[model samples]
Structures are given as structure tokens and as C-alpha cells.
Target: MKWSKSSRTLRRIFTKSSIGQNPTSKGKWGTSLTSHRNKLGTSRVISTELSPSSRRFTRRMPFHHNKSKKEPNGILHRSQAYVAFIDETFKGTKRVPRFMDDNNIVKGREAQRWIVDTALEMADAVRHTLGPKGMDMMLVDRMGNKVLTNDGATILKSLETKDPVASIIAEVAKSQEQNAFDGTTTCIVIMGELLRRADELISRGVHPNAIIKGYRMGLSQAIAWSEEISEEKEAYEAGVEAAKTAITGKSAEDFVDILSDICSRAAMVSSPSEMMLLTVHGKPEDAELIEGLVVLKGPATAGMPTKAAGNIALIESEMAPPQAQVSLTDPDQIKEIVAIQQAFLDEIVARLVKAEVKVVFCQKNIDSKMLQLLRKNDILAFRNVRRNDILKMVHALGGQLIADFADFSKSDMSAATVEVVESAVNDYVVVRGDGIKAASIVMPAPTEQSGEEFQRALEDAVGVSYLAVQNKKMVKGAGTIQAQMSYRLLSGEGCATADNSKVEAARRAFAEALLIIPQTLAESAGMDLMDVTVKLGNSPGLGVNVHDMVLEEMNVFEPLAVVQSAMSGAVENGVSLLRTHSIIMAKPIQEIFAEAERR
Candidate 1:
């Protein structure tokens, strides 16, 4: 009965050996704030009717710091510890404390439907914005910054709602975005239809428990059905298909194949590759891949050539004056220290010159003297290189990382084809060689805002495609997979023969819920649902042609993992709300303290 939210556990830790034997012994007692009790006495938390006005008492026990090693548990004061003491005194029997309080309660079907309805209220706004024809939502926050997007997570999160149930639903959409990386809108739409079907069954006198059980049954069948119909393509093919499907409802509809191809290439060469966006005074359609690793830094000094090709030397150590790193407290030795530092730098430059090394990449700082020495030796050097870039460079240039400045072994040096190119405002170092396995896709937009938006969309496409390749599974998109799963569960072949009415009910409800995706797709595209349905009939390849407003087989597809993630998230959330009968708002600790002192 002693509940604590910090660690998320409520347990009784008895301070004294015996409660009845310790009546004269001064100590604290356990406390239970809720009035709800299980009929079978098996539930951790239960639903029972009690007046919210009922005042329950709780004692504030003093926790003194006991330094003694023998006294493990701290001392407790038994001031106003009646409720838990009485409950413990009569542990087995129903002779419990009388002051349990309840705050929010709705009895029977009303409670079941009301919670689902409240959750769906948030889902309603985002469900319509699913599929290719989905409309964008413009959200203006308190600061009045307008964000225009069709992203389900964005729309749900941007809404300012005070209802707690509504927040829970919003959390589900957000969770989908975080976990699956896409399908935020599809998840909301699916769960909304799930509750709608559950409500429908409840109106027909179906028990809420039956509907919950049936929903589970239907979910299992839907998952199995989806698993069966999933079709996979080669890495590039699958990536292109997945990428195209992801951008269906997005603003870059015209460049679907072009975007998909770039994402596919990036995914194939670089698993989780870095995307670089450059905003030029050009159209977004001019996006293309660079056949080299993008090192955003320019050449270290103007004395270094803009382009050079030779054996590379990668130094993980600093190029600064070695004597500067040491301390010289005496003023008289300052000139001596400077001469020693200059000599130290002179040796490093001499070694590079002897080894015939062309370009030098240093992880740490380069002193001005060392820069001059390198330039004097006709060797190009870049300073303060990023660690990731350094690693990629080693992999690309086929070079070894030199940790010691004194060792200039020929084995440590490798080949590097370096070019310092000037873009609109900044310079970039493009490092490429035969050994590099990755590629960089650079896209330029007409404006900074448009370029950034395209970059974000491209990132989503690339991420999903990479995941699809790694997972090795996919499902037909354009609402085809959802349609198949829907038909499978609703056909009565998936769940009717189980002889359990509850499972049958859940299966039916689940099957009906799967139609939400295709239904929304049809609505968004302004096509007749019946007409689209007839066109896609039983063919796994056939999907809605969003562009031409016809049903045709196209490359629209999605990762199987994406659909699976959305299904699991939606079912878990819907069932959690379905099982609830009441919502409780606990009184503040001060109110309980006031009541305890009065007692």
C-alpha cells in the first residue's frame, strides 16, 4: 500500500516483527490511497465505486539518518498510522480501512466507449492525412512559428490538448515515429479504425472483454497474413520501391523515381550514410551523388595547392610546435624554447619531404610555423580534421593513421586524390580513391528552406531504405498490403472456426480496422472506394495508381518491418485503454498530511 512513483513499485516493508505484538512499539505503517478492490483479489490495481469526497489519512513519518552499520533500516515514528496498521492487523479478512477515495468513474459500456472515443479524438485529425493524396496541416505554435507538414507525429505533437486520454493517443503516434521512422499517420489511422469497430461491436451488445479478446485474435491473424504476402526485391530495387512509397504524400511527388534512385544508391553504398545538402540558386530536381567522401573543410593554408595527388600521410597527433606543449617558467629561456620548437617542426617537415608525401591530414591543431614549413616543403596539409572524416579518409585513401610524429615510415603513408573545390560560399575537400566503398549525395535547392526540407525528406527515405535492406523483408505498398490483411481477417477463414466467440469478435474487429488505410487512401485520392477495391481484387501486385487515378501494378512498396512495427504499437495502445473502467486523480500529499494530523 506504500506507493512510490519514482521507482515504480509499491510494496510493504514491515519495520517491526509483529504488528499486534508491537502495539506499544513506536513505528510507521503502510498506506493505500485507492478505494478500488478486485472481486477476485488478484489484480494489482482494481476498479471499485467510492465517493471522491471521501477523505483518506496518511502519516508523515520522520526519517532520521542513522550512521550505525548495525541499524540498516532507519527509525520510524508511528504518529497517525491507523489505516495500514488496521489493514495489516486483519490481513486475510475483508475487514479493511474505511476511508478509501475514488475521483473519476464511469460505469459499464459507457466507460469503455468513452475512453476509446477520447483517444480517437486526437487520431481523427491525422487519419485523414494518410496516403498519397493526404493533405498537409499548418500548425502555428504559441510563438506563432508556422510548421507545415503531413507527418502524423508532427500534427499530433503540435496540438495543444489538456485531456490526459488525448495525450496518451498522441504519445502512440510519437512512439511510432521514434521506433519505426515512418508510418506515423498510418498508425493513427489504423488505431482509430480499431476503436471505431470496437465501439460498433459494443453497441450491438457485445461484451467489452469479448471485443478486447477478439481484437487480440484478429491482430495475430493480421500479422501472420502480412508476413505471408510480403515480397522482397534486391537491395537497390527494394530501396527504390521503399523510397518511392515513403514520398507518396510528400511535396516531392514529381521527383519520386529520381529521389528513390538516389536514396537507393546511397543506401547500397553507405549503410546509414551521411547526407549533405547544399542550397544553390537552382531547382531541387538537380540532386545528384558525388563519387567521393565529402570533407567539408578547405585546404588549411593558401600556400597549399587547391588540388594535389600523391602518397598520403594521416597524422592522428598534433602538428603544433612540440616545445610549446611543455612549460618554461623562466623568461630568460623563452627564445631558447622558441628555437627548440622551430627545430622540432623543421625535422617533421624534412621527414615528409624525404618520404615524398603530398597531402597531410592532422586530427589536432597545426602551428603557423609548421604550416609555413609544410608549404615551404611543397606539401599540402589540412588541420583539425573530424574523427569520422579521418576514418573515412583512411578507408577511402587506403592510408594508415600515424600516432607518432617522429616515425615517418613509408608503410604508414598511402595514396590520396585530393581536390579543394569552392562552392557558393564555402570550400569543400573532396577525397576519393579506388578503396572508398561509400558515396555522397549532394542536393541543391533554390532556397535554404526548400533545400533543408528536401534534405529532411531525403534523409527519411534513405533511412527507411537502409533499414529495409538490413531487415531483408518488404510488403506491397500503395495500401495493397493493408488490403490483403484486411481481406484475410474479415473473410471468416482466419478466425471464425475457433469456437471461441471472444476470439471471433476480436478477429472481426481487427479485420474491419485494417480497411482504414485503403479507405483513407481512396478518400485522399478522390477515388471511389468501391472502384479502387474492384481494381485491386486479390492481386498482390495491384495497387492504387495515385498519379493517374487508376488501379495498376507499380513499384510502390514498404518495408515489412515498418508495417509490423505500426501494427504492434497500435494494438498495444488500443487494448490498454479498452481494459480500463475508471481514471483516478490522487489528492496531494499535503491534503493527506492535513487529514492525518487531525486524526
Candidate 2:
């Protein structure tokens, strides 16, 4: 029943009770309980005060047992009692019963504070590794493998954290790295600074909604100002500058010119999709770019020729013979099966020889017998090649990938020159001939860790170069663009509806938040942050020269996509973090698994 109707019914039932009637009208000092109940009838008036017996009646009725039947002694039905109790006790309040432990739940301002703090802590881990003067961090995994670098994405991904907020920040940094290719640290630092400003605003009683609105306005204005200040340079010049800017603060810093040349040339020939990395054992100065496919694997057998110049073939299946469906119990049947397998191998080798195929790349392993046959034919074959490598080689060498060895023919082959060069660590097979559009950068380093680090640097360099070439737009780096964005935001040059004080406060906070990048750069370079930020703020084309700890006209330019990508990601994630009002930490999955196993 509806609460209003149930309430009226309850009131009538109470009025008809003996205790609700006038005591004087009853006239008997000691009336029997049965007589009193029999005389109970509907009355217009209800007793303002409840009697002891009526109180006992209400207390004995359990609100939870609302589906039960009516009881004796004129007690109302359980549903009516339940409705009346609910309407009288909690009509306007929003309080709910506690079903979760207080320790695992963080609510209201406390949850917001926790989120901001956790994100800031994660950002701090990569804060110092921001600019040319930035320091590197040594990350050691559980297996005792160490990685020493200043790359923001590397540091964030390598660190272990249980906090969900930290994970979210790390994911945002990773997204920036993937999309912009060179702004992970800048993204995280901007996000952290945004959160810091938001925390301050919240302490002063500003609503988070106002903060989100202000941040959105600030992001649009920053993007617009960035576009206005961007300069278009030739693809080659921009590619070289972008590469040098990307490789400024890593182990490859000393070889920035050489690496930049390699990166620019590779990017000019082909986009990042057609580029690859080949690591070798040597010094960083020995790095070079090859205008062909480079496979780290060599010939499958020692007896095969290490170098061959002829048509190329790609195989997707293994070269081993297929098994017979039935068991061979008789010696004649076994011999027949062996002969069929031998015939299969011989047919494959003969087909390759007929096609004049001298270089073969297979996706799966080749049988020992097949390897011997190819060696006798003087064909260079590499077995167990990766599927990606096979596809790349097909694209670079103008060959078709054959699904089955039985289907191989002269039409599927393409002419190419292949050679296996032995290095200190391993052998590399270089394929250079027809259809050589793709290029690979052969990077050299002394140790495995250093090689890996150099590889990361080369990746960023290549990525930035490709972006710069594709976009053809560049901006001044080293805090110049950030300073300009901050100045424009605070000046309210484009914002027409900047009226409300709370939103204005939030907008100002956003403007200040963007200055964190320049501030960080100045601090890392051992210059006065205020002085450097002031100089850059006044000058449009001047940037921080970390080597000399002075503000000068910097020739360093970064791709416009990098700056825009980082700002957009930081603002979006920062607003998302601020909108969170509650955090419920669930039990760890490992603990849940343990409980399930025990059960």
C-alpha cells in the first residue's frame, strides 16, 4: 500500500484501541482484558499521549516482519506499522545502513585528497627527469634487472604501485608517449601541477565543478595560443631539430648530431611504419642507417652459404613431412611411408632450385633433411623467423609469402642480395636489393642495458622525426611555449565570459599550473626559477639554455603535436581526478583467489 493510505489506516487502528479511548468513559477501575477488547470501536478522537500498554504494543511490532499476518489485541497489520514507522522516522534524511567496512571506504573530501596525493606522488617519481639537466633514475625489478634512464614512460611503467590513482596517471603518461611520441614527462608534470592547484582551490571552499570548467577553458585557450605561435619549417630541417630535441637528455646526448642525421634520413625515406631498429655490440658512434631490411638471424645451417644473390622466397609453414593417419605395422608399409616423406622433401628442394631461389625466409622451423638439401643447392635459408620479420622482408624485398611449401613456384620469388655478417654478439643477415623502400637504424652500444637504453632513445628520435616531417609544424622548446601559454591564459585575451570569482579563481589556478614546466626546467638547470620564468614569459622566442644556465634564443624546436597532445591529456585526466568524490578499495584479486582455493 502507499505510505499515505497505510498511515491513515494505522491512525484509525490506534484510535479504536482501549488505551486510546477516554479513561473516564470506561468507568471501571479494573476492567478485564477480554471485555476491554470487545468494547474497542472506532472513535473520532485519539489520545494525544500514548499509554504504557500502547507503548508496549508498538515496541513488540517488528518493522522487518511487514509481510506477516495481523495479530490479536487490536494490533495493526505489519505492513501498516512498517509504513508508518518509515514515514515518521526517516522521511527526509538520506542516510543508509553501513554495509562496507569504514577502513576500506574513503568518502567526500578525504577521497579527493587521497586521489590528488597519490597522483602527485607518482608524478614526483619522474619530475626530476624532465629536461637536459635532468637526472636519471635506476629502476631495479624483482629479478634484479636494472634499467637506468630519464625517460618518463620508462620510469613510470617500471615502478610498481598499488594505488589506482597512480596507475591512472601512469596510463595517461603512457598514452601521451604513444600519441605524441615525446612528451610523457611533460604530461605527468602538468597533470600533477593541475591537481596541486585544484587541491589548493578546494581548501578555499571552491567547488570542483567550477575547477573543471576553468580547466576546460584553459586547455582550449592554450591550444589556440600554441597554434598562433607555431612556425612551419621544411620537413628535413624540422625532422633533424625534432630528433635532436628528443635525444637531448639521454645516454645518446653526446651522439645527438649523428643520431639526428640517421633519424632524419630514415624518416625522409619512409615513415615510422617502414622503419626498424637493429642493435649491435659496439659504441654509440658506430650507429648507421641501412636502406633495406635487416634480420638479426642468419643461415639455419652451418653448411649453407652465408651470402647469396638470387630470388627470395618466404614460407609460412614448417618444412617437415606430415604423419600418416594409420599405424604402419608391416615393414613394407613403413618403407612406403618413409619413401613418401622423402619424396615430399625432394619435391620442395627441387621446386626451390628450379625457381633459382638463393635466399629463403621461413616463419616456422625447417626439417633437418630439408636444411641439408638447401645447403647442397647453395641456398641461404633462415628458419624460425618471426612473422613480423617475414612480412617486413616481403614488403622490402618484393616477395610473396607462400602458405605451403608445395605451393612454391618461380612466380612467388623476388630478386634480392643477402649476406650474413658476424658480430661480437651474434650474426645479422642483411637483405638489400629490389623494392628497398624501408630503412633500419643499426644502433651500437657496449652493454645490454646501455643498448636497450639507446634503443629507447632511437625510438623516440625516430618517432619525433616522423611526426615533425608529417606535421611540418614546430614550436620553441625549453619552456618558451609553456610560458607563452601561461601568460595568455592569465591575461584572459580570448575568454569573454570570465566573470564569476570562483571560476576566475579556478582559471587563475590553471594558468599558474602551466608554469610548473618552466619552473622545473629552471630548477633542474640550477637557475633561479622566478628569474628564468619571468624572462621567458616576457620573451616569445627565448628559452632556457640548460648548459649555460641562462635564458637565450633557443634554436631547438619540437613538433606542435607533442605539446598539444600532452596539454589535452593532462587537463582531461586532471578534471577526471577532481570529479571523484568517493573511493572504495576492493579486496586484492590474489587474496580472493587464495580464499577461493581454501574453500
Who wins the TM-score comparison? 2
Q: Could you give the C-alpha RMSD of every candidate to the true structure, in order shown?
A: 14.1, 17.3
lDDT of 1 at 443: 67
Writing each residue's lDDT as its tens digit, candidate 2 over 460-512 gives 99999999998889999998888878877777667544577888888788888
* TM-score for each of the candidates: 0.64, 0.77
Q: What's the count of clashing pairs in each model shown?
A: 3, 0
User: In model 1, what is the error at residue 587, expressed in angstroms?
Assistant: 13
lDDT of 1: 0.68
Q: Which stretches of candidate 1 lie over 4 Å from their true place?
A: 1-122, 139-147, 153-181, 199-212, 232-234, 273-281, 308-370, 377-416, 433-435, 467-474, 494-497, 527-543, 547-555, 576-599
Candidate 1, RMSD to the unseen true structure: 14.1
lDDT of 1 by residue, 173-211 (tens): 888876777887788778877877877787887777787
